[model samples]
Target: MAIAAKHNLELKQYDVTNAFVHASLDREVYMRMPKGYQKPGTILRIKKALYGLRISPLLWQKDLTATLTQLGFQIVPHEPCCMIKDGIIIFYYVDDIILAYGKDQSKKAQEAMDQLKQRYSITGGDDLQWFLGIEVIRDRSKQLIHLSQVAYYEKINRLVDDQTIRHDTPMATSELMPREGLATPSEINRYQRKIGSLLYAAVNTRPDIAFATSRLARFLANPSQEHQQAADRVLLYLSDTKWLTLRLGGGTAMQVASDASFADNTLDRKSSQGY
Candidate 1:
């Protein structure tokens, strides 16, 4: 998306109709007829990869890769489901595809899309708006694209509170320690659920909570009242800063920054070789 906005590129969204079913099974497979269509002695021979099959995703991925490769795109190194050729980028998660290319490459983009359509029942082919539940908001005048998970984030934030209270920080200043007290299975599940929601926010658009969520995760096995409060604090923090969106574009370079604590893990204080 950053590249698309940076280059003022054309971004097209597409969905492969019955994506998995388009890939043929590598080996013959048979199944007993489903209840509604069962005949006493009959079995169904499955030729196409079916949705529930374990290898369906792999099969579909391979099929898509072959088609895209044939169209002159090469798999991007170290990136799954990403292909690029001639300044055009095509990446997808399962069947959701986004094709991005600069204005100068518009003709090539359409040609690639047309070739892909021949192999699969493609739909959409419009401006990219939503992908993987994240809303893509574009401001062409400013050449900026904003990614927001507000709809989903709001749904999770409401689980904490309805804005009666807000948090200034995602976690308290004091460090969290695992409880020695026995945790009920229900409590463990509850804590895990909280961490899951927080992790989603952290990964998508809430980097501010990454460290907090990581700290909260340490006590998943044995959560105490304090841990639950910590999780709620993070949730309330989300509620407090709910309107923030992650912006992409407006720059030619991006940087990644990282920091580390001085040996925080308590369980592994010393190693056999060294600390």
Candidate 2:
């Protein structure tokens, strides 16, 4: 959406400080005393949403949707996560929201955002930087929008001290055959941990790792030595291509093409080379 604007639109972001807390609870519930509260005989009477509760997210979303609707924003039928007003489009993922609109609607949206922020525990204005771990980079000149997770890679590298690892293609052309032996309990645990981290990286911003991550994740409990090596290859790939990012140019729409060969899975044994 930003790409299609071509610098004529401005992008703004805002965060709901305690989004769940803003949600009105419909059920009567009680909570233990908060740490600082001196209510020795009192408990928190449920009035608003709180994390870990089953109904928290739903309540927050309901309230948030209502608030946005009241502000003259029309919820897009095709996308409940999106709202539109005049030329402005707003997309929300829980508490984090992105507003995109031309110059005229920008100020009005900003005003509404300011009013909302004041009424609720929300953060707004131009200084908002990161949202949901996704780093936002705006090309004001070309009006291009790019989201990446290079910071996340750095964090993982620092944690594992794998910054110097080499990068390789995520997948191998070779096929695998399952073995009859069971995996050691400790080995299985370790494999699951490593694969979990890799999966997080792949889903966040590293599309290049998607294939490799998915392929290796299937053998988490009883992975062969070959699978372990393939997992390492993914780390190496990240190390070498640490700067690679998904770049979005000025385009009116997104077009994706995919080709799949039936029986692509090795279990089915049909020769397939697809992207």
Candidate 3:
């Protein structure tokens, strides 16, 4: 997504129909006949990959790699899911594909799409608005692109009790200590679920809550009441800032900063560092 913004590229999305079934199986496999197809005692041999098969993804990936390579796109060394040809880039997550190209390469992009359509059954050619649950907002005039998870945040907010108060920050500066008693089984389960949801957001676009979430994760095995409250605070924070997005582009140069604190962890006497 950052690359698309940096290059001022037009983004498009495509979905390959029955993508897994397109890959032919390399090994001979058989399955029992269905109830409706029962005839004597004969079984059916699988000719193509199926959804339940563990090796289906590998087969699909291999097929996609071969097809892209034949189309003059080379798989990126560091990112196997990415393919590049000239200045245009193609990124695929399972069956969904996102295409990015500069203004001058619109024809090339269209041609690539055409080639893909001829090679496989696909439905696309529209400007990208959403992908993998992330809402993509592009402002070509401002040369900016923003990624948000408003719906995802709201969905998880429903899981939280209505009494949770909103907060400006995901966590407090005050130190958190283990409570005197262990949490009940139900309480522990609920805390784990909430933490898991928050962790997903942190790893995706909510870097602001990453540190707090990571710190709270330490007590997952036996979270205390205080820990549960801290976790709830993170959800309340998400509700308060559901519209917050990660913006790319609109900057001339990159800037980075780092910090460190000696012996910041009270329990382990370990130093903390961040960039």
Question: Best candidate per TM-score, number?
Answer: 3
Better of 1 and 2 by TM-score: 1
Best to worst by TM-score, what's the order?
3, 1, 2
What local lDDT does model 3 show for residue 163? 40
lDDT of 3 by residue, 1-275 (tens): 88788768999999999999999999999999988989897999999999999999999999998999999999889999999999889999999999999989999988988998888899987999999898999988878899899999988886575445567888888778776777788988988999999988998889999989988988888888778778888988987898899898887698988877788788788887886
Please give the CA lDDT of all the candidate structures. 0.85, 0.72, 0.88
In angstroms, the error of model 3 at 210 is 0.6
Please give, for residues 1-114, the per-residue lDDT of candidate 2 as tens digits.
Answer: 434345546677777888898888999989898787867787778888889899999998888778878878888888888888776677889888887766767578777777
Each model's Cα RMSD: 3.3, 3.3, 2.0
Give TM per candidate. 0.90, 0.82, 0.91
lDDT by residue for model 1 (14-83), tens: 9999999999999989999887897998898999999999999999999999999988999989987899
- What ranking of all candidate models by lDDT puts the best one first? 3, 1, 2
Please give the lDDT score for candidate 3: 0.88
